[model samples]
Target: MTVVVNENRNKRARVASATHVAGCRMDLNVRDFAPMAADEPALAGGTDEGPSPLEYVTAGLAACQLVTVTKIADAMGLDYTGLRVDAEADVKFRAAQGAMSPIPRFSAARLVVRMRSPEPPERLARLEELVEERCPVSNLFLDAGIAPEVVWAIETTG
Candidate 1:
């Protein structure tokens, strides 16, 4: 189904390959992150900050999906700027009835996609639909369970 789009501008999300050793404590890889630009420093801390690897994983789900939404708006010719996903999470043990696990059992992230576009609700909803269709990362978590499965692609090797 071809949705008519005026103004051929586009927005897309890109990622590089990564690796994380299954149970090794030290060698872990992360693919999703905004680089520490000159504007933002790496260290602004008390004991609470500097996201653990799990936090990065959770955040990636939200940010990657929101980028998908942004691309949807762009393709549909919705004049917009400044899209953001404000996400929050809580981690807890799934079956620990009474034990307080010092380590988090699993983390949760609630995504609040902040969008600034001048489109009606129906159109916006359609845009979201298109985004969901196009976003592999979002679909991976939403439709299928988040199990790791690497696929082979015959594209340019980077």
Candidate 2:
């Protein structure tokens, strides 16, 4: 969520996100744009109308990985026709609830990318390496010593 302010002459990119309570849900607005609702399940006390905060974090990481991979593939001229990314995070519930641990965030995260392409395996591997080095979301976890594991499943299709 980067926005370049061309009129400011500094050419700085900033992300503006705000959230407010909308009944039993939270409405998140980015740059005064589309609003997404974040809610917990009935078991968690709120209506199960939208994804939870942790789920949104996982989704953001997955989406960031996809974008990074796509950019790398495009730069390398890889002809990938199909792409799927699945991401999940393991959080310490006890820590979140102040029951234990040092942090309340994800302890670990994983990403599985399935790609359909005719590109060589070596090229795909290099692309993966680049994505690992460049993805901001992945780096956030990596810098924090979470060290997310990324698995690539490349399948050639006609």
Which candidate ranks first by lDDT, i.e. highest?
2
Residue 30, candidate 2: alpha-carbon lDDT: 74
Q: Which stretches of candidate 1 lie over 4 Å from their true place?
A: 1-49, 94-108, 143-158
- For candidate 2, the clash count comes to 0
Task: Please give the distance, in angstroms, between residue 20's alpha carbon in candidate 1 and its true position after superposition.
Answer: 11
Instruction: Please give the distance, in angstroms, between residue 50's alpha carbon in candidate 2 and its true position after superposition.
Output: 1.4
Cα lDDT listed for each candidate: 0.51, 0.81
- Tens digits of lDDT, candidate 2, 1-158: 13233587567665756475764588877776788888977876678778988788899999999998887788777899778899989987543345543444688999999889987778777888788888889998899889889998888766
Error of 2 at 75 (Å): 0.8
Q: Which stretches of candidate 2 lie over 4 Å from their true place?
A: 1-13, 22-24, 95-104
* Superposed Cα deviation of residue 17, candidate 1 (Å): 8.9
lDDT measured at residue 114 in model 1 versus the true structure, 0 to 100: 63
Residue pairs whose backbone atoms clash in candidate 1: none
Indicate the residue-level lDDT of 31 in model 1.
Answer: 60
Write the residue-wise lDDT of candidate 1 on 56-118 in tens digits. Answer: 656776677677776667666776556666645565645544665244544434556665665
TM-score computed on alpha carbons, candidate 2: 0.81
